[model samples]
Target: MPSFDIVSEITMHEVRNAVENANRVLSTRYDFRGWKPL
Candidate 1:
C-alpha cells in the first residue's frame, strides 16, 4: 500500500508561451505549413 499526495499548478503564462513557440515553429517551417494533410 502507498499513500501519496501530488500537487501541481501550471500558469496560463507558461501555457501561452508554449503555444506561441509552437505556432512560431509551425509558421517558420515551410514544408509543414504548406503541405496538405492526406
Candidate 2:
C-alpha cells in the first residue's frame, strides 16, 4: 500500500512559492482571461 502526506505545516517561503506557482499556471488559463474579482 502507498500513503501520502498532506502537510499541515508550512513556512512563509512555501506559501509564497505556492502563490507564485498558482499565478504562473493561471496566467496561461484561457478561461481566466476576462475573470474579475469581487
Candidate 3:
C-alpha cells in the first residue's frame, strides 16, 4: 500500500517563484511599456 500527504508550503513556494518569473518577463518586454496601472 502507498500513502501520500500534501503540505502546501512547497506548493506555495513554487507558485511564488512562477509569479516572480512571469513578472520579470512582463516587465522587461517592450510591448508592456507604457501600460498604466488602473
Candidate 4:
C-alpha cells in the first residue's frame, strides 16, 4: 500500500501572496480601475 501527504507539500503563503499581487495589479490597470472582487 502507498500513502501521500499532498496538503503538507503546498505553500499557502506563496499562493496568497501571488493572489494579492494579481489583485493589486488588476485594480491599478486601466481596464479594471474601479473593479473590486469580493
Candidate 5:
C-alpha cells in the first residue's frame, strides 16, 4: 500500500495579469484581431 498527499494552487492575480497582458497584445496586434482565449 502507498499513500501520499497531493496539493495544487493557483495565483489568480498573476493569471489575471497574464490574461490582461495577452488581451492587450491581441487587441493591439493586427494579426490577432477577433481572436479570444478560451
Candidate 6:
C-alpha cells in the first residue's frame, strides 16, 4: 500500500472563475441548454 498527496495550488478566485466559466458555457451552449446536471 502507498499514500500520497495532491496539490493544485489553485486560488479561490481562480476556482470561482473556472466554475463560473463552466456554468456559463453549459447554460449557453445550445446542445447543453436543456440538459440538467445530475
Q: What tens digits encode model 2's per-residue C-alpha lDDT throughout 1-38?
A: 99998879879999999988987788779988766545
Candidate 5: give its CA RMSD in angstroms: 4.0
User: Model 2 Cα displacement at 18 (Å)?
Assistant: 0.2
- Which candidate order results from sorting by lDDT in descending order? 6, 5, 4, 1, 2, 3
lDDT of 6: 0.91
Give the per-residue lDDT of model 6 (tens digit) for 1-38: 99999976979999999999999989999888788888
User: In every candidate, how many clashes are there?
Assistant: 0, 0, 0, 0, 0, 0
State the C-alpha lDDT per candidate: 0.85, 0.84, 0.82, 0.85, 0.88, 0.91
Q: TM-scores of the models, in the given order?
A: 0.60, 0.60, 0.61, 0.60, 0.56, 0.63
**Of the pair 3 and 5, which is ahead by TM-score?**
3
What are the per-residue Cα lDDT tens digits for candidate 4 across 1-38? Answer: 99987655658999999999998889789998877678
What lDDT does model 5 reach? 0.88
Clash pairs, candidate 3, are none
- Model 1 collision count: 0
Candidate 4 achieves a global lDDT of: 0.85
Q: Could you give the C-alpha RMSD of every candidate to the true structure, in order shown? A: 4.2, 5.0, 3.4, 3.5, 4.0, 5.2
Residue-level error in angstroms, candidate 3, position 6: 13
Clashing pairs in 4: none
**Per-residue C-alpha lDDT of model 3 across residues 1-38, encoded as one tens digit per residue:** 99999875558889899989987888889999777545
Q: Could you tell me which 10 consecutive residues in candidate 4 have the lowest summed lDDT?
A: 4-13
What is candidate 4's TM-score against the reference?
A: 0.60
